[model samples]
Target: MSFISVNPESDFSIHNLPYGIFSTQANPKPRPGVAIGDYILDLSQVSKLFVGPLMRNEAEEVFNQTTLNKLMSLSYEAWHEARQTIQRLLSKHEGVLRDNSELRSTAFVLQRDATMHLPAQIGDYTDFFSSLEHAINGVKLFVDGDKALFPNWKYSPLGYHGRASSIVVSGSPIRRPNGQMRPIDDRPPVFGPCKLMDFEIEMAFFIGNTPNKNGDIVPIDEAHKHIFGMVLMNDWSARDIQKWEWIPLGPFLSKNLGTTISPWVVTMEALEPFKVVNVVQEPKPFPYLYHADNYNFNVNIAAAIKPDNGEASVVARTNLSHLYWTMKQMLAHHTITGCNLNAGDLMATGTISGPTPDSYGSMLELSWNGTKPLTLSDGSERKFLHDGDEVIFTAHSERDGCRVGFGECRGKLIPALAL
Candidate 1:
């Protein structure tokens, strides 16, 4: 139990001390912090207490860094030990931090007064289409119904390199991009505001530990040690632009506009209690991608939409367990070709739609390529997002009356700038 009283339903309980970067008005520089109830434990002010054997040497540097990359580059043993130290310090039963009044005042800051920043300085980003249902639903709309799944899809994880420069922390505005799209068959392409803007509900994991060399391939069994934690993600899309440019090469302007991620990174250790059986893979993946134990977590993800000055309407609900390719498999496949991965690199699970229509993760699938319109609770309809529409994505795992969650990934769509 923590010395601080936390609501039973709050995501920042003693069991879930997720980390982030924040800056208060009084202290304008971003620093490392841990979430506890309604307050933020400023690691910058309490770095001295991390005197455990694993972190005594580097506590100050790790906690004082503006971004999490420095801490993430440390050894896995260090990461594990740091979490243990933090848990003990916050424990109500016994600990120096819980009993010391002066230290507590300096280390704890109210959440409302702090501005959250991107937890890590992402060097690169990759988006993976790991959900089987999402692929099938999307393929059926763009390709022949009988040939939904591509032949190469089941063999390996499919992904594309994405723009790291466009990733923004939650609460940032996503300006609708102006791009080229053909309105009719045999018509000239016109450049204007994106007409088919959409939001993709997804989850992304951060890389920790030292990076591999250009030729080193990380095995599947050792992949978990390299993963630091997860955050909710919303990959904004322009459907019309994607259709025109995705013939020989993959996404370009259609996806590079913007992507949003939650500030806090919920550690994998905190979500261990919610682990569920992995989805059954057909034809059995190659030996390199196989893992005997289940790697799937039963995290419930949902999306909501709020129009200009209107009440929020729940749009979709899905789960991470619905993913066909496990995270370990994706990591192993990523390096099999001798590619290197660096600390703070992000890998995302592209739109995680489940088996049912109501569980679809994007408007393109929920509305069936604009053939139908999604009806909201307030007697409103939407086939594609409009300017001033805010999309919010949230995720959590509940077990034994404890809920650990990635707070929220939210962004509002603003009008595109004039050409």
Candidate 2:
């Protein structure tokens, strides 16, 4: 236990020291940090204390960097070593930090006074359609008749390369996209602000330091070692634009507008307690995507919407365990074709919707293609997000008095720029 008091339910307990980047008033430069209780423990200040065998070689330079990419480039054994060292320093009986008033004052920053930044310098981002429920719901709404799942849907994880440049930290305002959309009868597309603004509740994992040659495949059995951690994500969507341009390729301007993610990256080491049996794959997956062991997580994710002047109302509740394709399968499939992934590269599980309606992970699904309207606590009904509406996402996995959480993925819709 840490000397500092942490609420039993607090997301940043000593058991879960998620990594992030933060800047305090005293030092405005963003540097690596770890959340504990309600304080941000500046990893830069404690860099010298990382004398463990696994971290000794890299610790000196890892924390001084502005982004976490350098740290992320370290091996899993190194990451585990760093976590173990941190836990010991913060433990109740440890005199390393708690006993030293000057060191403690210089190292810990109050969470409220700190500003968080993107934890990694994401080079490439990929989004995968992994949830069976979400995929089925999307097909039901978009496909014309009895046809729902595509023939290849059951065989492998389907994914698309996304724009990494548009990914932003939580709290960044999302500008409503301006694009071309057609009318009810498929008239000529008109260019203007998007009418069908929506958010997809997702969870993304950061890649680790495993070096794979450009032409080498990352084996299914070894994918976990290449995965660093997970974070909550909101993949903002312009449904109308997606509908119009998705015939040939896939999502274009409809998705690249803005994607928000929580600051902290909850390491797989911290999430091991919440592991669950992965959703069963039907029709048997291809040999390339097959993994015998379960890679599913049991994180509880909840999302809410708040109008400009209204109270926030919970919109959806879901779990990552609902995904039909495990993240390891996605990673394995990604590299099966010899596509190399670098450290800090992001991979997202697209819209994790559960079996029930309340477990829907996106407004597009919850509103059912605008046929259903969701009522907020402010007596406002919404089919899709309006300007000034804020969407918030949060997640945690708890068992036996231990809880690990990704703080919040929040973004407000700002009106499109005058065009």
Candidate 3:
């Protein structure tokens, strides 16, 4: 496909074809749009003014909805159909959308003036510690490298239920949370603002196609059938709070603050060409849990931190392939307990740090349990995220000679006010 005008740097390039909800800042009503040439082609507006024969014939109801959820709930074939339709409409060919001047006036909106909104109405969220390297590193920091991995990790995907209500759109600032922490020297837990705020470098899988019948819980092998797409995710954390509260039941106050997701949802169909085996196992998965392609995609992920006022500092570079458990494994494990998943639900890959000091995903690990500090390029030191720290996560796949990038997932930190 010929590259369209939305500069290559723009997240919505032809290779990207990411979907999101948008509207002009003046009107901010939250409607569907496709990024094209420094502009957002408003699907809602295009649905009304578009006189194109093919699009008019096949434009599904998803385009009419305010968010991408309607489109996402459709089947993979349906998604492909919509993508093809949108691509053609966006093409620079003479007989394409440009054929109608009035249509262009109504459909095209500048991206800068556009207000980006949540891509979907997330119903529920589940976080999984799917990265072996990350889990080992975390263990090594608290325990040691020899027993870096714990029980129930090598066997299946270890995960925890997360808060959906707290998830936020990109650019929204996160607040430093009030949490309970313990002092080292024979002191009881004290209440104060979290001192070790951090961001988890990860990716999120979006669920779609809810099972309708009595046997509604989807099997592991068929999990992909119900998924919509993937997004770059930053699962923010408060290490100080987690340490105090996490004696028995996992994360609570530390995780509930705010999680951020990239504005665009990269469709599952776009990634179909590059599916590989999830894990190399001698003991294959059980029959019911196994389908066909049980492999993971080679999606490259990275994290960066920038002061609210200054340039970004590169943090970690990792990939989904490094994950011990794949999305399929996580889904299989989720439904192994017969849990029913709904449309718009999210399954996240937990903290994705690699095995090294420089590859640490969070400051807690890089600082070695707060023993050291990270020296930034600007000569600043960071033991933990401060009041004005901003973190960004980006995920992309370079396959078939195409670099498909999912726009940055970002959040700013604001200090907690005394209550």
Q: What is the TM-score of each candidate against the true structure?
A: 0.98, 0.98, 0.91
Candidate 2 per-residue lDDT over residues 1-419, each given as its tens digit: 89988988789999899999999778999999999999989999999999998788788899999999998889888989999999999999999999999999999999999999999999999999988888888888776647768878898899989999999999999999999987564578888999999999999999987648799999888899889999999999999988888878989999999999999999999999899997877888888788888788899999999888778899999999999999899999999878888999999999999999999999989999888999999888999999999999989999988999999999999999888
Give the per-residue Cα lDDT of candidate 2 at 195: 96
Writing each residue's lDDT as its tens digit, candidate 3 over 177-255 gives 9978885628888898888888888888888766334344567667777777888898899888887787688888889
lDDT of 3: 0.76
Candidate 2 local distance difference test against the native: 0.92
Instruction: For residues 292-362, write the lDDT of model 1, one tens digit per residue.
Output: 98899999999999998998899899999899998888888999988999999999988899999989999
Worst 10 residues of 2 by lDDT: 139-148
| Model 3 misplacement above 4 A | 6-10, 48-60, 143-148, 212-215, 282-284, 291-294
